[model samples]
Target: MDLLRRRAEAVPRGVATAAPIFADRADNAELHDVEGRRFVDFAGGIAVLNVGHRHPRVIAAVADQMARFTHTAFQVVAYEPYVALAERLNGLAPFSGPAKTIFLTTGAEAVENAVKVARAATGRSAVIAFTGGFHGRTAMTSALTGKVYPYKAAFGPMPPEIYHVPFPAPALGVTVEDSLRALAFLFAADVPANRVAAIIIEPVQGEGGFHVAPFALLRELRALCDRHGILLIADEVQSGFARTGRMFGIEHSGVEPDLVTVAKSLAGGFPLSGLIGRAEIMDRVEPGGLGGTYGGSPIACAAALAVLDVIEEEGLIARADAIGERLSARIADYAASNAMAPIANLRGLGAMVGFDILDAAREAPDGLRARQVCARALNEGLILLNCGVQGETIRILVPLTASDAIIDEGLDMLAAALAE
Candidate 1:
């Protein structure tokens, strides 16, 4: 049977797969499908493989751990890799005060535990997120998430005490004042400020368009959380690790958050996520309250250690800034050269860059053109991903390991698609 036909028969329709081909192998920034076709991978498994697919060091680490023994269950028999990883992440946290780390299996799990920790520590139940922020697919996170339609639609009767206010996007006409006013209104009309336990936000709104929260606005939220005695949670699931220029996106704002949830690109392809926060706040959760059977698996921890090493040795943190500059410059030049193309509001933080697809008159976001551009790129051996609630944004999640040649090639393909 054809692969797409086979997938249709076996997999549920609710699960969305962007690329149609079945990958036979992937390395660095390219994926080879079952039909033996090569495609330059700009999506990076949606920002999961910053060190690129199957980096030699990461492969070696996983191999060595598997040979020793894969699972004794860290809960059943403690291991050193898990502890070592926690120490490394805790040390890497941007906060000055003492921090602690807890491992989980996915970004959603990290998010859930962050909220749980906030509620436990503060003895308050209400939580607030921003409009257009994408947290997770779980019930509470679904409630916390700002978008509806595909994520929250038909999954209703959501958990309560979760509210959303506007996030600043000056080009979109949503200003910092507009966001602050919405928050003030939320406090008055909906949940009271004192009742709120946490206010979670994405420094760079992922899956909701790469709208980097303004530095002043984040500082403002930090002060508000301080006044209300509420924990500030930064959902760095998509922008964490070295994907952005800094280790954490929130660091760009120079504001500290009480808790940060991380996952994608943490293990260089292994399933791992972490929730790091102030030690006092994290300690409030009772023993046995956070963590799962598969949480912090030794194999994943080993891979994570190797990932950190690769980031340092390859100087990927610095490379991310360079890549962001290159991508942004090339895309801007492409837009200038193609006057008829409808690209606008090009923005990003570090390597996490994207542009809005607008109508020919540049009056409105154009979801149809965005989708067509992405599909056209896929046919031309370049894999791209779209974002925003209206699907009117195309964001580059290219692997940091991609060479200058491959980056140019992929951008050329993107430019070709844009012209189409």
Candidate 2:
């Protein structure tokens, strides 16, 4: 209670936390508050802890790096860990041919740098994004994001030449054809195809509610970009690493993008983001054109290296698939039951799962009741989050490193919350 009061006074209201509990410690898929109460972490720190909280390997890597040196600033004094991580990411790039990578501190930085690189490569100023898609909270990303109310509200006048088309979410009554037609209309009426520099999309929409991009739409986008000379950028900020049963979500579509923005789970829990792109496009930016003071922090690089090792050694990609199957089966059972709230539309790729609370009529989204379920689940000692344009989604971002028992326990809490 005192901590809550202190938080209310010290923090700005704009930076909202999903739960009021203050973390004392966390391990794997569980967190303990200062009050010594435990909570099953279904949120995974908003998809940043795929390897789980404070994994021994990640901690050791950071500690080792610290013992060597904390920071000389990669830009000022180059570090081996940064270069090694970049090389590792480049080799793991989803696209064919030679690839390159540049590290940053946040998903937003990777996305913004992607746009800059795209513009430099294509010599065009306009960029395209999809409705209901979330890139980031930065001014440029906010303009790119499709949602209004919170992300873009009262923030304008936004930067110029950032346009959005409807994302094909059938549940939301926006079909793939509808999305394609809107893009056609956008080209004819709003911005010409030739003037567009890039079309950025999340292979699986994260903040827009775990909607997996239709492979058909991805193929069409690839063809359109090919014909128009526009770069296709896959923003894997929330869906990267092993969260989607693949190293990157775009891997599911089999439609290679020119550039990929990766973060969230990249460095386990460390603040490390990066852009992996084609060698030619990446080289478009001149020397010293791209970098940050703490862009590739040695500490974060060490952690990220350990994270990659963990993903491979732990077989997390396959584990993501197994976890997804388990989650989907359980959520489906809940949806079939009359005892639970009107929940439907359980969707996701791999372990990145989400379902929506609907009205009694089973039609429109029930944001209020969804909020209620999240609150109830929190009271039940499970941390959950809601997304989608209407805040009607219950997203499950459990760590891949989580044990089956932990996942089942979290799901059981979810069932109780739904019953309430």
Candidate 3:
């Protein structure tokens, strides 16, 4: 706690609320601290290390790029890696028409740029986002984010005209029709639909919980957006890259979004994000309307290219489905057994899985108990993350590359923690 406490004082207080573990090194799906304590990494750097930690291919790519050049500021002198990476992303995205890709440094940048592009194309000022969706921390993204406690606590006076509606969860008593009703209500009560430029969502909410948006709901949203001329933006920062079985989370419904924002595991660990959209729509932003000094760093682009190679060669998308099936079955077994606290409303797609902790009476959500279980799991050498509107659900985002032994060990720790 000494180093962490010091960090709290030196760094902005808002940036330090997660688990206090200070990692020294990591590999595959295991992390070691300064004191040499080993823990199975179920968090995967908040789902950024899909290729696992310190992947050999990613390491070689970065090392090889570093030997040649680290920075040239894509705006000044263009690089081949950036162009090639964008080409790959454009082809891989779910869009049927010709697509264009723009690289950025983080998910928030991609999101902000996507919005800018949407506004530019539609000439509208308002945007709609769903509650429980986690966008990012930038001023505009903070405004776009649906959760209130941590993301919007002190940050207020957020960008205006960003309306929020309920995200559907049938297990939680909200249906697709309910979501549609909310959207209709928003337009009638809050803002007019014609003024809305875009509606962005996480196909599987990240910080909100691993709730998969229903297929019917996504299709309806797409239809609504199409009819109303509102662009559909899918924020795939946490659910992208084989995390949800499909390369993109939106693929679960077989619907195509006008724009898709991707980051997190896109570069396997490097800081890189991209906005992929229809070529005609993406071209709305003029030459200088989109871009940043470090938007497409050469090193990050090289690492992303390597990540694509690894995903293809390793068949990670298929592996994600298998992993999720196994994990869901194990969780279902634990839920059936009364050995640990009851897991209610267990749901997810692919490797993104979550279950809510039930109350002592085994009825309602027990948020405090969920936090305790996460803490105990961490102490017992397993890493887990808690989510949900009230923080009552536990979500697992283990690397697609993690082995069966590691996954089982992490689950055992979780079971023990719940029992305690």
Instruction: Quantify all predictions' global Cα lDDT against the true fold.
Output: 0.92, 0.95, 0.91
Model 2: ten consecutive residues of lowest lDDT:
149-158
lDDT of 2 at 209: 88
Off by over 4 Å in 1: none
Q: List, residue by residue over 39-154, the lDDT tens digit for candidate 1.
A: 99999999998999999999999999999989887778999999999999999997889999999999999999999999999999999999899988999888888999788879
After the best TM-score superposition of candidate 1, give how far the Cα of residue 19 lies from its true spot, in angstroms.
1.3
Q: Judge candidate 1 against the unseen true structure and give its global Cα lDDT, from 0 to 1.
A: 0.92
Q: What is the full ranking by TM-score, best candidate first?
A: 2, 1, 3
Model 3 error, position 60 (Å):
0.4
Q: Which structure among the candidates has the greatest TM-score?
A: 2
lDDT minimum window of 10 residues, candidate 1: 333-342
TM-scores, all candidates, are 0.98, 0.99, 0.98
RMSD in angstroms, all models?
1.0, 0.7, 1.1
Error of 3 at 221 (Å): 1.1
Clashing residue pairs in candidate 2 are: none
Give the runs in model 3 whose Cα sits over 4 Å from its true position.
none
Candidate 3 lDDT score at position 408: 87
